[model samples]
Target: MHIQLLGGFRLDCGPGPVHVVPGARRLLALLALRDSPVPRRVAAALLWPDTTERRAGACLRSSLWRLVKPETPLIVVTEDALVLGAEVDVDFRRACAFAAAPGASPEAVTMLKADLLPGWWQPWVEAERDWWHQARLRALEVLSDRFRVSGDRHHAYQAALAAVQTDPLRESAHRTLVELHLADGNPAQAVRQYQSYRTRLRAELGLEPSSHIHELVRPLLR
Candidate 1:
């Protein structure tokens, strides 16, 4: 089973196009919380907290059934819990884990292609989306550290470049690019990034770049 959490939620199974439904995304988020088995009642509360218990239970049941197909079991319900079926793989979780680990792997970097569920707007969606953002950034930092240690200047440049693309506003992204360029003996590129950051900060916030940043790039001015 293929599960998508990058935009609203979508689940795909064998021999059929992906299914889209309301509430399925919530169910997927509950299941994505690692090995923790979400209690039936808790899932009900999160998805329909303001509703009556009876109504919430009914909604959960309906959402679960929507994934049913003769050929695939997308979800499994036990005596009192719910989980993504054994056949299903949760990519966000995998991506988060890989990104957090010590070494950089292709799979880990690929996992952070976009922010989590760019299309969803529910409160719960925001919570998970924030989580993935912070997690992905942390992974990029780890990759940068690994590359710097190994003297992999090219990969280091590439990783920092990708990180900034993911979060252009993050001062750390600009900072990382600056450091990577300096280490790669490209101080001119570092100065260019600094100037870009200066313009962005002035335009967006009407403030100057931090003194620390100004200090770092001072020697590189050509």
Candidate 2:
């Protein structure tokens, strides 16, 4: 069984996609992300923060009931702990692993493109979402550097561009992208990118690009 949390939440078994109700979906999402046995009380409390302990436990029980399927058991509930079935594979974990690997592949890059559960506003999800955003950006920058060092300018540019697009306010991303443009004999493009970043950074944060970023494009600009 595959549980996808990046981009969105989906569960697929051998047959096909399995339908999960909204309330249960949140519970399943948390379980898939945690990837370990959580105490029943803790799980209940996290999922239903506004409710009393008794009410939260009841809600957890209800959601667990809704998740039960005769054909496939999606969860493993112990006397005091809850976890997703051992057979389940979470895409977020897989993508994170791929990002840290030594070499890049088409599949890894594709997987890295997806954000973790975009538009999910739960407190439980926010930290994980931020974690993914930072992880992906770092991975993109690393791959860009590696590709650039290997004389693969096109892929290097693509990776650097992706990093900048992922976080427009990240000066390091813009610097890397500008370096790639200059390396590829596109000084005008490098200057344009630097100017674009300068404009946006000024408008958004009322700040200028750092000295390091300026230095990267200074030679080309002159």
Judged by lDDT, which candidate is best? 2
Question: By TM-score, how accurate is candidate 1?
Answer: 0.83
For every model shown, what is its TM-score relative to the native structure? 0.83, 0.92
What is the lDDT for 13 in model 2? 77
Worst window of 10 by summed lDDT in candidate 2: 101-110
Model 1, 7-66: lDDT tens per residue? Answer: 335666765547556677578766864467778988888888889999999999898877
Runs with alpha carbons beyond 4 Å of true place in candidate 1 = 15-17, 70-72
User: What RMSD does model 1 have?
Assistant: 2.7
| Residue range 87-175, candidate 2, lDDT tens digits | 78899888888777726555666677788898899988999888888888889888878888888877777777777878989888888
Q: Alpha-carbon error at 219 in model 2, in Å? A: 3.8
